[model samples]
Target: MKVIKNIIFVAIVFLISIGLLVVGNGYDMYKDAISKIPLTEKVETIKEKENYTKIEEVPEIYIKAVISVEDHRFYKHNGIDIIAIGRATINDIKAMSFVEGGSTITQQLSKNIYFTQEKKITRKIAEVFMSLEIEKNYNKDEILELYLNTSYFGEGCYTVKEASRKYFGKEPKKMTDYEAIMLAGIPNAPSVYSLTKNPELAKQRQKQVINKMIEYKYLTQSEADKILEQ
Candidate 1:
């Protein structure tokens, strides 16, 4: 019994040590990234793009679709969503891999602007830190706008305006309900859902987006049906 207790204690300590090391490295990476390019400067560069579209320029349906599909609790959470993290953690454990990420919109924006796409614990932590910083400095609308502008929508479209013109040849504000929802779903897996590359897959993802919108109460079933009819 004594030996078993000792082994358990050692294991707990070892795990705690590893956790600390990971957190420390992540914090360092966050600091280094900010040092190279201040967050404000990075944001300015993006906003200064001639094609940048403000939140007001986007359709309400598109906004709702994105919030429903990407982060339903976007308006309620701070920079992080604890419930989402817990759910993702369980899913990741079950899969025995980093298969599910619970990144909030703010966190995704942070990663889009500052970090690489590679999935690593340290980078994930750094992204969290950056998210907190962004939340401190920007309002919800600003963050959402920035996220839309930075997100890739396949076909080499880097901003929402670019994607809108590339896919539909119309401004975002003029997008039909169906078009808005379809565009909202593209960012989830742009490479696979790019309308030109995979029209069928894009339609499937649009259905997923509409389902999420209904689940989140952003759209009624009838409204979704109407959108589909279009």
Candidate 2:
């Protein structure tokens, strides 16, 4: 029993040490990135893009769909979703790899503007720090708009407006329910879900988005069916 207690204590301390080291590294990376380009200036630059789409300019359904699939608890969380992080942690532990990232829209926005797409613990931590900064400086709707404007939608489309025009030859606000839902899912894995490249996979991903919407009560089963039928 004494030996077992000692082992557990050591393990706990080791884990705490590793956690501190990771967070320290991430803070350094965050400072470096922010020094190069301040958050406010970076966000203003994105919002100034000719193709930047406002939250009101986008379809309500599309916004709901994105919230449902990307981060259902987006409105509830400040900058990070503890529930999502806990679930992702469990999954990653089981898989023994960083397979699932429970990134909130704010965190994704932080990465989009400040950090690389690299999947390192330090980068992830930096994203968390940046996410908090974003939440502090902007409203949730503003953060969502920034995320949409910066997300890559594949086929060289980097903004929601560009993706809408490229995919359906329409503006985001003019998108139909079906088109809106389809567009909402593409950014998850844009390369795989790009309609021009893999129509089947795009449809499959669209179904996933629809399912999430229904699950989140953004749409009923009938509504989802109608969208799919269209």
Of the candidates shown, which would achieve the greatest TM-score relative to the real structure? 1
lDDT of 1: 0.95
**Which tens-of-lDDT digit does each residue in 1-230 have in candidate 2?**
99999999999999999999999999999988988999888988998898989889999999999999999999899999999999999999999999999999999988888888988999999999989988999998988989999999998888999999999998889999999999989988999898998999999999999999989899999988888999
Residue pairs with backbone atoms closer than 3 Å in model 1 (clashes): none
Q: What would the per-residue lDDT of candidate 1 be over residues 1-230, giving only the tens digit for each residue?
A: 99999999999999999999999999999999999999999999999998999999999999999999999999999989999999999999999999989999999999999999898999999999999999999999999999999999998888888999999999999999999999999988898997998999999999999999999999999999999999
Distance from true location, Cα of 151 in model 2, Å: 0.4
lDDT of each: 0.95, 0.92
lDDT of 1 at 129: 90
Model 1 TM-score is: 0.99
lDDT of 2: 0.92
Residue 26 error, candidate 1, Å: 0.5
Q: What is the lDDT of residue 37 in candidate 2?
A: 90
Q: Quickly count the clashes in candidate 2.
A: 0
**What are the models' TM-scores?**
0.99, 0.96
